[model samples]
Target: MVLLRGFLVLVMFFLLGEALRVLADLPVSGGVLGMVMVTFTLMLRGRVSDELAEASRGLISVLVLLIAPGVVGVFFIVEQFYGQWTTVIVALIAGTLLSVLTTLWLMKKVSESAAGDGRHE
Candidate 1:
């Protein structure tokens, strides 16, 4: 039941995000919006429940498999990218690197701020 509730929370956010996207005609994907909603909720709560953490851990374990279909779909359209291979590859690499760096920086900033709140550095 805990897992079920956790899953429902995720689905609820996703649906809410989709509704907002349709209503606002936003450029971002519903999934991204859902994540933003999740982030906001987590921030407001200030703590993650064990059930949600467990469910999120389970999702992380299968994240690669979740992305496999999209990666495979890219293969089907490989030819379209072939003509702009250089640009495509460069963009992919740059985007991935930027994402990694941004995530790392944010993590460091968050952790440091968290640590600073009542502990000597």
Candidate 2:
């Protein structure tokens, strides 16, 4: 019942986002917009409910299991990726590095600000 309620919250946000997309003719997808809305909601609320946290943890724990079929399917389409493998590899590596660096930089800045470092600004 707790998980159900949490899932319902997610669905509600998604539907809200979809409605806004259709009405406003926004460029972003419903899923992304939904995430943004939920993030703002959580920020305003300042704390996650126990049921939502539990549900989120449960979903994370089985995430790998959920993606297993897609990973397996990649092997079946290996030939399609052969010619473009170099491009794919480079893109993947660059994207990963960029994300890591960006995350580290943001964390540093946040920490500095939290520590009352005027230079952070």
Candidate 3:
């Protein structure tokens, strides 16, 4: 019963995503939109059923395996990236550092705001 409910919820989201895709003519895929819709639903509902939780966990566990083929395909472009390894490494490092700094700054700002509101210890 739980699995059925979870499946129904997933199907509903997929349909909603497809509808959005059709109505808006967005370039994003239906599955990606479905995921976002699911996330929004979960956020609004707060708690999910055990079946849904289990289904999500099981799906996530195998998600990496599903993308393995795409990863393997990267081998075909190895030559194109080989000569640009230095550039790729530098871009990756810079992006990582920027993300980390941005996250830290945002966290500090949030904490300060909370403290100002007397919501902090």
Judging by lDDT against the true structure, name the best candidate. 1
Q: What is the lDDT of residue 11 in candidate 1?
A: 83
Candidate 3 regions exceeding 4 Å error are 1-5, 42-47, 119-121
Candidate 1, residues 1-121, lDDT tens digits: the string is 8888888888888999999999999999998999999999999999989888887788889999999998999878878767798898899999999999999999999998998985964
Q: Model 2 compared with the native: what TM-score?
A: 0.65
lDDT of 3 by residue, 1-121 (tens): 7767777777788898999999999999888999998888789999777888876777788999999999998879878777898888899999999999999999999999988889544
Kindly list the per-residue Cα lDDT of model 2 for residues 43-111, writing each as its tens digit: 999998987777778877999999999899988988977799889999999999999999999999998
Show where candidate 2 strays beyond 4 Å: 90-121
Q: Which ranges in model 1 have alpha carbons more than 4 Å from their true place?
A: 90-121
Instruction: Predict model 1's lDDT versus the native.
Output: 0.89
**Whole-model lDDT, model 3:** 0.86
Error of 1 at 20 (Å): 1.1
**What TM value does model 1 have?**
0.67
Highest TM-score scorer: 3
